[model samples]
Target chain A: MATVAGHPETPLIEPVDRGEGLGHSIVRALSHAPLTILLAFIGVMWLVPTLGLFFTSLLPASVISSEGWWTIFSTPSNATLENYRNIFSDEAITSALLTTVWISIGSTILPIIVAALAAYAFAWMDFPGRDWLFIGVIAMIVVPIQMALIPIFSLYDRVHLFDTLAGLILFHTAFGLPLAIFLLRNFFVGIPGELLEAARIDGASEIRIFTRLILPLSWPAIASLAIFQFLWTWNDLIVALSLARSTQPITVAIFTQLRQFGANIEIIAPAAFLSLTIPLVVFFAFQRYFVQGLLAGSVK
Target chain B: MTDSSITAEPPNQGAPPTADEAGADPGRRRRFLVALGFLAPALVFLGVWIVYPTVYTVVRSFYDRSGDAFVGLDNYGTLFTTDILLTAIRNNAIWVLVVPAVVTAIGLVFGVLTERIRWSVAFKTAVFMPMAISMFAAGVIWHIMYTQDPSQGTINAAVRVVSDAVNPPGVLSGAAPSGDDLRGSAAQGYRLQGELKAGEVAHLGLTRIPASEVKDGVQAVVPATVEGGITGVVWRDFKPGGGGTAGEVEDGEVGIPGVTLRLTDASGAEVATATSGADGVFTFPDVGDASYRLGIASETFRESYGGVSWLGPRLITPAIIIAYIWVWAGFAMVVIAAGLAAIPRDVLEAARTDGATEWQVFRRVTAPLLAPVLSVVFITMIINVLKVFDIVLSVAPPSVQDDANVIALAMWRTSFGGVNDFGLGSAIAVFLFLLVIPVLLLNVRRFRREA
Candidate 1:
């Protein structure tokens, strides 16, 4: 075992620097400062608006109108949780929130899975028309979503998917798959081809190689895709407005307040803030993945 | 490592079944299936939604309001001749020219500036914060700011402060004082007693005091007998290098101060004022295709700069510059940041060994490598700017929307806004699509090459 570890031949490894003690600490700290600040700024910027909205949601409707949310800190003694209570108490908002959760989760999971499989084939599986197929997919990004809305609405109406959650899910999944595959395919292409080829030589099937080698190797890409898909679908109002019936998403639900004449800032500020809560959480949880994903297609 | 590994993996593992020995071709079969699977979903979605609607919009432009009967190029003809659509087109041109240029300009500048700042991330995120809030949401914010009549609105209140300051007691109560008061004042300074009364003739100085002396919004406040207090105060809007002739007041009564008019002698000599009605409507009476000076004013205060000044507010230029700045700065910042991060440390060490200054290393070595990212950023920003719809749509009011709209907004109005004329809408949409096809092609080409 010792001989195996030492292997006097030692594979002629390249000498690596492991700078020591205080020098190492200083270098490490200096190297990380830009990223730390970059990340911290992204965090705080994201937090304030979302937090403002959340705080607004917790206060009574009357107070939000008369004063700015910043005033809450100066007069913390007069806070109330009635706005959130009202959201839950009201059947419309609660139902919409649940509807949003279901649609966002379902849409995100479906596209990530499908896009992963498709990306794997494009990246590794050698088939004719693969390049052409990928180009066709990339071309979809140029198709203005506005042009698609009425047509999709008409198509869904005919198919009786017009008012269903399945309809909205299908639309989001379909639109999201192009960019998803485009991004993930690039990431997958970067994977050391030797790893997958090695797995195949060991008697592993294509499916096994995909599940074991490719999918796990592509976790960062997949995580990023999932978060983006989740955020996009959650924030989506256009499709939901055109497709969803009374079973509205949180975005559509908040928009309804936009129409309530002389609409109180209390409801809007809180509702908009509350709506962003899940996205903020998802973003923070996967900040590293999100940043990696953002840099994926552009830099490489 | 490669060939031996392939051999170590038995042929039975990854090797295709030797059915090819039985005269069956695997490549052909795989190609057929791959094409079918890869293209099936995208084709279905895109064909139904994108291709069909795009084709539909082109076809619809031929029909009338009902879209039932074919009337070829009548819509185009109407678009050319009709005053309203012409106004809409003019406005849209203003929008297209201004919004993208302004947003991209602002975005790029800010994007670059913030990179040098200590708390750049904070500032970048602050400016980029509006991007996260959907356009409609931003509209809500701006809508509150621009809400008219409610002195509480940000812009209206700011305007009122200037209005009160300029006019002193009563600004809008009585009609504007005639040009005679201005001429009479110059005469008074010259010690000439000239009683200028209504319907009375008086000789006045024509010294041609260069107009620069009168600043825009610099109003004359005079004491009045009535409760409204300020009366008969003339508004001298200073315009320089306009080449616009002095206003000739039309036969009709002036609606507002500083409005453009066409004054003609009884023998019908022509004179045109550069200023327009409160509606910003300029008359081109008998002026036989000559250049003219126009002075326009806005009391609107930009949020970035507090208070207000009625500087030379060109009808379209300022708006374009503003929108361009807002969008591009953030894009440049993100791409430059990425480019900076990707610089390999060993390359910097090599530069250091060569005795290069840090500035030299950055300029000579770092910037060259960032070229690829910079091109991608520039191309993408151009495309994004070209397709800009939301900022233009939200910033301008509906009344002015028709006149100050972009192609994207015009397309929306034709299709969905009250008229519901799908055919014309489709035509406009298709035209917009054609405008962007080159950008899209470049984007795809870049994606393929860069990716």
Candidate 2:
């Protein structure tokens, strides 16, 4: 009988001729040893710093410097919420946080909606220069932000968009549309055309067909795109820094603290940890859809 | 869930052949509307931010600072000839060369290796954490790590601690105390150079001088004539204040008007002094194996004695590559892992039963089967890398970034980094638009082939 170690049903559990095959098993074990060590080393090197950041974020500032963050298990009483409290206490920080939230939400929703609609057009709707137009949109992806900054800034300034939040959101949405459209269009195309045709036969218009049929079936993709767009916007510092010239985002606000804080690991450790929380939350909520969204165009 | 009925006959009969054909006309109208709707906001935004300013920058680059007069490539000519501009270009080139290759190689190797682990998710998340942090934040973090002092820096402290335990004189702090003769007969002369310093640590010939005595120290070093072979105390001295045997030089060796030179030997012994001529030439005797220090007094750039410029929080291409690899490798791994899972066990069993080697079977069968996955990964990476901006902007040199920068960083710099030069910025953006089109076309063609 075969009995897999993890999955009991799959492993071969034959005990026949154990002594005869002993040398082969040992050799096999030796060969696999290197792989095991490599994996462990890679995992530890990658995870420790992040884990340290996470642990340090939870502890008091004084504890972060004097002791390793791993020592939190020994002194549970050293933990404090002061860093986060300070983060929110500042008007600038809180406003920046609010600005970030708004920007992330707006940028994510707007781009996804626009991209999905455009994706639908490119995917299913037959039009003249359909391929060419999409190619144009996709081409926009390579228009590096550097080439556009001064022009964008001056344009924004001319139109009085210097430091406004609305300006930043618009700028992000413009740049974000190309990639979002590319991703969602591929996913929308993967959906069986019969599903949309089936809906249309029952007297639903193209818009209705999209709203009820394509949108629901493409929820997984939409979720994934939402995550990507949201995170991209949330983690964005340059575009926000440039376009949001007046209003600061979390990235900028955190940066100002760094200049003043110097080696105050208490503030920086916690702040660094706190800064990532939103993205992590977004990831946890949308990760299930990531696989589905990713597989949409690849499988069929 | 929809109220749509299952039809015995398909809806394609009365329509324009099939769905692909049915919407040929209506689809065109719909697409026109949709593209118009989609492009409207983007064009408006891009027009203002990308198109307008970029075009403006090209125009501005040709103009003076006030931008009132036409100067016909004078600005670009100036940029080439100016010493500062030359240095800036060199630094930028170094950044371009070092950053991308290192970052990409590390990323690709790690991405492949980490995929085999059971706990790959955790491993990837950790590495990708830097991606989530803004470039500015990453810059700050790296700055702290690269900090000169060990007490305040994690990297330096670790180096010092390891070196101290092993070699004794501390690796990072100062000379490893090779116990070699530094102050013997070999140390007959020294130079009076200064830089950003930490606590007391013995280096080759560097010395700490009090801030109050700098003026007098310069005076004591100057000699009557800075003749060649002017050996130790072989040269007489004078001060500019007393107007002694020292010549009434117009300016110091560095050529700056107010700045004076105080040359010292390799052992911190003051040797001679000279000021710049009217043409801004300050001459001093050449010394062997001696380090020279420069002090600047300029109107454009302001600093006390020594301060580094362009230490802004920005990633060059290499850092971007490293950061991007961290961010996207997880994505690539997960996709590849899923594709691997999808391969049926019977295929492997069939290969094993046929006496085929595992490597051969995997290569011929698994790799070929993973073609779709490979295409997807390649396309995504290409797209992602094309749009990368934050990493570069957050780590690039601060003072001299211009249109000659990367496409994305230039876009941001021109718009908001003051002096908003849009026309030229837009022209470059148009070029960027040209560059990305082929990649996007390739993606569309790949999907079209699949379809």
Candidate 3:
């Protein structure tokens, strides 16, 4: 909160400075108008293609092939939900959705449980070689999953984790741990020491102190990190592509179908919407926690 | 509170042990055990999944395709020698050089612009929407935009819409004459049959322009000509009929309008030139009553504004990279905006009050202040781009996948994607790892410094 910002404080009438009087809202708007316009353009530029995709998916497939999504505005009656119907009926996509949901949820739960414990230990426990160990774990964040891909493929083949949902959960958990541990440990380190001290005075064990004292205080951080981990694992394609066989995540299924035949707009458009909507919904629902988690790591 | 905790000694600091804390020294060992227990699961996964595989890949890079034979350095050799892999390496090099800076720059722009804006939250949310979708999904959306057909592709359709109004394409799209009456020479399309009498009507049947593309029921206007001038009707001679005479225009056939034909004498000397009318009829003015051949000018038949070949081999890499930017530029914006939010308003305000323009403030003050966050974003993007796989694989069509291949996708293809050459895959994995190490070390150093 005390981080130095690049803009200077200006003399402004705070709302509370003059109760029932004018606030700084209008003055602030006038001052920041140009920058707001720039940001507005950038935001629209970013969203237009996605908006096009969404609108295009809503229109009937026959309309989609011959006209741009922009045409829907001119001829509003042409839109339909047939694309969604097509996607929902596909057996392959449904199974892929199930696999993706299980993988995302599994990856999220496993990492949070394991990372919370490890992060608590790293933050509070006076363990031998803790810095070296924590540093090593943090360093793994930079080692991309690609480096381990080929060998892991062979390893999965040997161990029978190949083509299994458990295999994906395990891989996602391992990758998720570094950031989870880093973010959680940093958050855990900042907890008021008096809470732990009071628990200690009550003759509580370390487990009791951690569970009773730290976990409740760490919920906001934990929630945000979970959203991040879940979003990543859910939207992942490379890991699923490398590790899974027989049962594939939705991303990989979309990839294979699009690659094999990209011509099917009714299928690809709706399948894409189905794939993106889940994470986007998860994202919007937890917007505060997501931003809190992102800023927690960066605000340092 | 944190400062107090860091400075204040614990209540039990002076005592070795109390009744409730008996064997506290041995408890150090117990604490270590507890820490070890907590850390075990993650370590096990990391060791099996990351550390061991990394070392194995490094060693496996030395072997041959099957991983059974011990062929030291040959896999590494093939990385340099193989055409596809070398192209992959070269393409990865381009990707590494380009994508990170571009994404980070955009992120920086949005981040700084939204700093003082009232609607920054909504703007940031909108920009970050792409970050929610998988790169595969982004690729799908862009595949729709980059389709070869203009009617289906959003980008090309937009281009066609805008370009058609401002710069309408010339008539007579690269169509040519067909049949025995007029045959093409190396220089001109469809030279006149045998020899030409001065006043004979020349009928040159053409193909390449289908009957449906031509305008129907258009009357031919043959301009009046003086003595010894050539007159011709160069319409789309073929009809919608399943079969027809080769060089004769039938009912409902339309003219190949705006075509220009030339008169060449026996010695190939230039004569007069006349452009075809809107209805494919043309007349050259007075000539000295000499025999001449009317040949179609190649320029007359050539078409302009063929839509951009987004999936062609030449443009495939950049096209896919555009899709990548469409997805990731938003990611960059969101992350950098987080960093931007942490910037105090005082510095930028001071810079602006000191009479610096907005652009100057951005470049000198704001950019320098954002260096830490910008570096973090840049380094992370560099690492991500080095291992880029899914976008390239999904976005680039099979015809041009080799051109758009990055090391990570290349590695997949070499090993599990039909080629099944683990050694080559391992080498690529190792190569990618080595390439990422410097920036990874830079990032680790930054994080450590921040910590």
Candidate 4:
């Protein structure tokens, strides 16, 4: 995910002015139509490779190699539900789904709760080193996560958090917080001061105001951040591979299933589809707020 | 309910009370503790998981593999010379150089192009769908698509269809001469030893190709040689039961078409070259009476229309980057699209009315304006590519995984798994962190400038 500045400077793209004669302008309009078709064509071309695999994954592996995947269009019965069924019947795959769900939920929720507090402080509270501390937190965004894995992994062993779901949850939370705070604090600061002022006048404690006012009103921001964290932790492989060992999450599970020659489509296609499809569904469903979270980072 | 409840005041708008002035020592201490309390969990996690470990890595990098004896900078030095690490660095340079610029450029185009289209939402959603897939899964998909076998890999299959149409299929590997009767070296293919007359036909047989694999269905036809012409059959020499003589043409052996025959003079100087036909026979007609030795050129062994080896040690990094670009270009597009949406139309119209063409407007107006979004996307991609691990791990075959390794993956494999060389891994980690500083600094500088 990246961000766009919402600065007052207007974006620089526009349809060309066409004040010429009607014949010339008709030429422009017809030209515009082709351009539209060209863009759409490029979009579909961009999509076809992934689309090809998706389609192939639906067919039996026997059918996949014999004929072109596109041949299935003419011969519709070639597709099968076997791969998706195999994912559930297989013991390793089914449990990986559970692990991924548990980790995604834990990793998303804890950081938001923790970062909400930190964000509120950064947004509103007066404290020594607030700017520097907030800057320090956000600066960690640039540090490659590899820098922390080994030492912290050993540290986790000493603390007995290694190879545990809780360890990875904490790991995601640590890594997730800085970006969450940066995003959430930006949102929290933009809330009208008068609304908070009124609550303060009503004798609301800091905790009460945070829960009653900030938390309730900041749902969109929180939701956006939650979806992002969920997708990230859900799709993560390196962390889960390096840490947690009892059972695999889908990311690592699919990775481990890979053979030396190539992937097993029966497992990878459906498994990947299952892994990719869920968050995409989540993303599209909550997309209104999702873009808000995305834009928050750079708009400031 | 109470005056005490009202004591936790918001920042007073009129004249904010200084920590010491209006609030006595106890009150100031209370505010400090509350702020610390709010920050505690975040601080604790960041400390244990990120800060402390980062500091630990830096310290450990100076020590030996067990992190016991101090061997200052030795790990770092090892990183420079280690083949995999150096390759990782070089590959990352490729990633840094190629992926971001290409992704940003494509995204910039998509952002601009989609602006003119009506189905922008559907288009963007389609493009950005790959972001939902993990790099591991993406690796699986792309790996399948890049399969070397035409039956399995979509890319190679398409290439096969196109190349088969446009060019003749020269046998790619698996076909070679099988006998001591094949008298030529690897540099030159075999020739008939006992042949006396130039007008006679001599047969040259190869053994590796199955009869069914010959390019055309027609049977091999040996033609009578013209004056000074040398004609021979290059067919697979072996038969299934070992009944066929060594280096002699046997049934069920396929002809190796497209083998070049070089006829050299007795002085071993000038020679003529002629390629075989579909039936493994070639003719070289000449004028002079000097006897010439016939030899097979090396090109016959090569696979005709063979697709490039995308997963080979050299190309694996670029292949993975193509996958990475497919996954992220849409993301860049969406971010830039948002930036594009922020642009005011008036200036664009003004430029248009002032006689600037569409290309000029795009280059001068849209591009310059979208630089911030582009830079942000580029920097983020730089950050991402530096830490790329999953695809390299998942996509590269275990045999060549070392060849395709990135810094992050190298760090993992070096320290743990089997190596247990935490010192070297930490050094790599530290090396990666240093590599990231320039982008981080660039991002920080941009943020400060904007702030």
Residue-level lDDT tens digits of model 3 in B164-238: 777665455556557766778524555777777666777766777755556642644333443576687777766
Which candidate wins on DockQ?
Answer: 4
Q: Tell me, what's the RMSD of every candidate?
A: 15.5, 15.9, 7.7, 7.7
What's the true lDDT of residue A167 in model 3? 87
Better candidate by TM-score, 1 or 4: 4
Residue-wise lDDT of candidate 1 within B1-451, one digit each (tens)? 0011100011221212221333346755764575456446655654655567556666777877677889888777765676655665565555455544444444444443455557765665555444334444444444444434422244445566677666443112112123342322221121112322222222111223233323233322321323211112223222234342233322221223343232332343434333433322333333333332221112111112222321122232244334344334454555456555555656756664665544455556655555545555555555555455554444454445554555666666666555767666655666566766775676466445433
Q: Of the candidates numbered 1 and 2, which has the greater TM-score value?
A: 2
Model 1, position A228, has a per-residue lDDT of 73
Fnat per model, in the order shown = 0.07, 0.28, 0.46, 0.42
Summarize candidate 2's per-residue lDDT along B140-220 as a digit string, tens digits: 444434333454344445566676565443101111111232222211222223431112111221112222322322222
Question: Each model's DockQ?
Answer: 0.11, 0.18, 0.32, 0.34
By lDDT, the candidates rank as 4, 3, 1, 2
Give per-residue CA lDDT, model 4, range B112-140, as digits (tens): 77887788898888888787667887887
As for DockQ, the candidate ahead, 1 or 3, is 3
- Assess each prediction's global lDDT (C-alpha) against the native: 0.53, 0.52, 0.74, 0.75
Worst 10 residues of 1 chain B by lDDT: B1-10
Q: TM for chain B in all models?
A: 0.52, 0.47, 0.72, 0.70
Off by over 4 Å in 3: A1-42, A55-78, A261-263, A295-300, B1-23, B115-122, B161-167, B172-304, B447-451
> What DockQ number belongs to candidate 1?
0.11
lDDT score at residue B17, model 1, on the 0-100 scale: 22
Give candidate 4's chain B TM-score. 0.70
